[model samples]
Target: MKVFVYGTLMQNHRANFLLSRQKYIGPGEIYGFSLYKVSNWYPGVVPREGDRVKGEIYELIHEAEKTLTRLDDYEGEGSLYQRILTKAVDQKGEEHEVFVYVYNGTVDEEKYIPYEQQPWRG
Candidate 1:
């Protein structure tokens, strides 16, 4: 399955270290979502019209979905972040639906910095 990842999981981040050790198929870009930084700790990308979130597209290999599920669980999925299907567009302007996680629960949107203003370099 193809999955879109922004935030710490971008191609050149600490999170990629974990991803590199996984059974992933490939990496690409997915657009059409708006990236945001929540509470200056993590990232969130939401599907929005006329918005584009630049991130890496990964194809999970074999049963990588199960591994991903565990990763999500470790990240507090369904609580801190909820996995959902959303449309993402690539750099070439191509669109595809992929599974992604968005910050949920009681996130303070007002405190969220725009993706460009993300404070965490990690």
Candidate 2:
């Protein structure tokens, strides 16, 4: 299965160890979502018209895929974030339907980060 990673899980980020074994599918962007700095440790995203979030796509092996549950727990799936199916455009302009983690809390306008400055670096 494929997943879109925008923040901690993106390449070169501190939390990338989570998907170090997964196959990177290259850079991709999901539209209709705005990225925000949820905290000093990570970022959150919410759906917003005319917005986009840039990130990377990875293919998880069957065994590695099971780690998603762990990732969920780590992400506080029921509260901090939610995994959802969404469409993303790859570097080649190909559209792909993939799983992505989205923010589950109220957004703060001051925390909003522009698309070009995404994949949230603390």
Candidate 3:
């Protein structure tokens, strides 16, 4: 399974620990969504026309199921964030269907970090 990560899970971030064993496909971008920082800890992506979020695509090689379970817990799936399968475009322009954890809670606009200052440094 492949997952698209934009914040803490990106390379050199705090949560990279969970992704160290996965195969990094490459840099990717998801269109039609906006990425926002939540309390400076992590990012939440919401659907927004004409918006795009930069991220990295990782493929789970050996422990797909187990890794997904852990990732779900980390992202607070079913509560704070919701896991959804979405299309992401790689640097080469190829599209991929990848799971992304999107914010399910109410957003406070004041905390939104613009794309120019992106990839939230939590």
At residue 40, give the lDDT of candidate 3: 59
Candidate 1 vs candidate 2: which has greater lDDT?
2
Q: How do the residues 54-77 of candidate 1 rate in per-residue lDDT, one tens digit apiece?
A: 566676764687768766865678
Evaluate model 1: give its lDDT.
0.62
lDDT of 3 by residue, 10-122 (tens): 99988889988999999999888888766556779888898888889999986999999999999999999999999998989999999999999777788776667765667
Worst 10 residues of 1 by lDDT: 22-31
lDDT of 2 by residue, 59-107 (tens): 8875665778867877788788999999999999999888889999998
The C-alpha local distance difference test score for the whole of candidate 2 amounts to 0.86
Q: Which is the better candidate, 1 or 3, if ranked by lDDT?
A: 3
State TM-scores per candidate.
0.70, 0.93, 0.93
In angstroms, give how far residue 84 of model 2 lies from its true place.
0.6
- Those runs of model 2 whose alpha carbons end farther than 4 Å from true positions after fitting are 62-64
Q: Which ten residues in a row have the lowest lDDT in candidate 3?
A: 113-122
